[model samples]
Target: MENSIGIHISQSALFNWLIIFFISIFGIRDVLPQETTIKTDSHAVVSVKASLLPKGLLGPIDISPAVIPHDQYPIEPQSPMYPSFPSTYDPILTGRCQLNFSNMASIIDKTASDCSAPLASLVGNVICCPQVNSLVHILQGTYGKNSGSLVLQQAAAEDCFSDIMSILASRGANDTIPGICSIDSAPLTGGSCPVQDVETFEKTVNTSLLLDSCSTVDPLKECCRPICQPAIMEAAVRLSQRESSPLDNAKIPGKSVGVDVLSDCKGIVYSWLSQKLSLDDANAAFRMLSSCKVNKVCPLQFKDPSTVIKDCRDPPSANSSCCNSLDIYISDVQKQMLITNRQAINCAMFFGSLLQKGGVVTNVYDLCNIDLKDFSLQAYRQQGCLLRSLPADVLYDNYTGYSFTCDLSDNIGAPWPSSSSLSSLSLCAPEMSLPALPVSQNSRASGGSRGLGLALTLVLSSLSYTQRAIP
Candidate 1:
């Protein structure tokens, strides 16, 4: 309660400060009394010279000290003016980056706006971090063009990464983006991966196979089929073995690499890919690759379920308490962030098991009338949209800014996990109320189900998702 009060006070103070700054820069003549005036020292509120001001939408006018001590004022009142980008404002560049930043104005502007300091913490997961990741991947390809090598040397990585942050900050992006996105210059430097250059990476890994597998992604089933992920992992493992002796290499054919080593090598592989593919293709492939990681689990954080357990332990006897307590808990959950429908299912099952473990035997979701969309940040609560699992990304344009597709064709009931336990529950598990299209669509008998019939069924089963723009 105190925290909420503090936040409200902080927001009110911030709004008041912004209003003052706006008034000082562009004098609010209409709001000011016609006969009223004030006298103060330097950097204080002064008068506006309507006649002397630049004419015809000349942009933000500088409040020169010379304009003060005006004798007569215009009798007619004017509307409040506002500030905008200064005429001479330009991003301070390091002049070290080989990539031409001028060519990337649109994306840079998009990233700057999306990842601005005021907005970063609020939308980091859905907006800011995604754009930051995309920008880094795009920069990798662009910088690789002139350097011939996709990955940068350590010194260059330091300089270029600094320059990237400087450019974004000058354009009003969050300076703490590295921390916000958990990124560093390490990826640009290719991490601790032994293979940095293209020639050695090609010689060590099956370049042709890697390229063929990931050049294009089938969005619908890439998460399930996982053609590119394994290929990337295999390539990363082979690349990680560059420093190993021939004997160890022979013993570890297609063996798994350690966690850190595998991640570093994957970054190296992605750099090598940037050196080969166009920027658009690389960015798309990277988004698809990222989707594979986010597809399996729920991103929303869950709190302790003690309150829910106590209130929801009994069924019809405790209906009012159970539903009331559940609605409160779910409201808190929904404040986490927007998530996809597939992720929502996992979240429901996971949370249900938590409740079941805490002595809540009954399915509270059925009693509380919880929907799948209830598991995510619902802007419209009773009728809000939840995102689709795969084929999701932040789309940007001059007009639309950033947006993502959302499933809005009515809410699906949050499936109550049976007493069968969470381990036995799978998306492909039958006897469940949720959709099950089987694990392998291609392995169907006579290849008949591999056609569009089952695919159409899969599409219709999930209903429709629309592009929802966050304000």
Candidate 2:
């Protein structure tokens, strides 16, 4: 296969790069983040729209829709960051499905971007798989709008599932969504959930409380306040028994039985709500729930940093060697993948503790003045993406392939441990207590997203976008 590569950099950033280039040509030192205010307040923050476009993730380009005009799509002239697509390009679709793909077009576009070819394997566990599962529930609701069925039957499920994969493949989306997520048509068939019908579920559980708690979800406070999750758990527990079964009246597991049974019941509960609520609301609520889970932990796997510790064993009073090593190490970390703000904290704490154990007595973060954004993919550490700790989703436009929001907090330092840190600290605990590090800016903002304005978010799987993609 031949490689078809293109980059779409924002016009403003390209102009800035040119300015830096010219300054260097005149022999004047280029001013950088070293001149910005080094102090950080994670509390006072705003989101910057950042797009981590998967440059080569979709594999060899498929120019299926033959000849078309490109200028029909109206967007600010982006030089070379996102790959441009035809605004009017149409995909070959299956006509047998009950749900009109036209109405669900935006989400279908997002699915393609989230589950793109190369990205599926890298971020399948955290981003890709979870999104696919959410999409399924939403699709179920949309499909049964007129019919009022919560779950699809065996034959209908097979046809609709085929239609979905077909549409995604026709676009540049990855075809391996099922295998990558370890899912099957089983979810569409209601899987192990005993209560497949809406009537049984509504009658068995307290539908009123469930609807009140989850009809509207707050992405920011839901995880901490936890109104919906507790309600869902309560409903699922009750449904797990359901008094009796339609199959054989067999007694299923009780509330305190195996976790697997309860989990199945939770799926049923979601399906029940999907029928009761509108499609958009279901999508939003499901994505927000996913956001809560993904933002909780560090998704990147850290390698042994024997070399970074060795090079930074002592601070040099004369040369820039130690700081040089520190910068190089951080740059390498930033190239791994896009990370959430909360994950950045865990990553920072982990590397700091490692250095301490390795005999690097001094705090390298202080010495170098490395900001929290330094640990994420960035252009020279200042123009970086520290993903917000809220419900973030991959976006798709007629022009830009996929984009997301990132908090552009200025020069937030990575918090060094006062002593040793236990890995079991729960910053998200309801008490909001920080028994590890002393209370400060780090404690308050560590588990929270950037306050206020939202601009969309994407945790990009890989950082090979700027590099040329060849196969």
What do the candidate models score in CA lDDT, each in turn? 0.66, 0.66
lDDT of 2 by residue, 10-90 (tens): 566788999989978766543322223333476654443224336576689766543434454557763444455423335
For model 1, the stretches where C-alpha displacement exceeds 4 angstroms are 1-89, 103-123, 169-175, 244-259, 316-319, 380-383, 391-404, 421-425, 428-471
Error of 2 at 299 (Å): 0.9
What lDDT tens digits, residue by residue, belong to model 1 across residues 1-471?
Answer: 999999999999999999999888777655543543456877577765545545666678678754554333445542222112212246676677666777667667767876765446545665567677777767765676664665776667777788888888887677899997998776775555666667677789999999998888777657666788889899999987678445433433354335366777888777777667766666667777776666568777787878889887766453477788888887777665667667777888888888988888876776666777688655533544566555444443433333445663343567777767566655532444335522222234345332112211111112223323232
Count of backbone collisions in candidate 2 = 9
TM-score of every prediction relative to native: 0.66, 0.65
TM-score for predicted model 2 compared with the true structure? 0.65
The most accurate candidate by TM-score is: 1
Q: Can you list the residue pairs that collide in candidate 2?
A: 7-80, 7-81, 8-80, 8-81, 9-79, 9-80, 9-81, 405-456, 405-457
**Model 2 CA deviation exceeding 4 Å by range:** 1-83, 86-103, 110-130, 144-149, 153-158, 171-176, 179-183, 243-259, 312-326, 356-361, 380-382, 395-402, 420-431, 434-471
Residue 178 CA displacement from its true place in model 2, Å: 4.0
RMSD to the true structure for each prediction, in A, is 22.0, 24.9
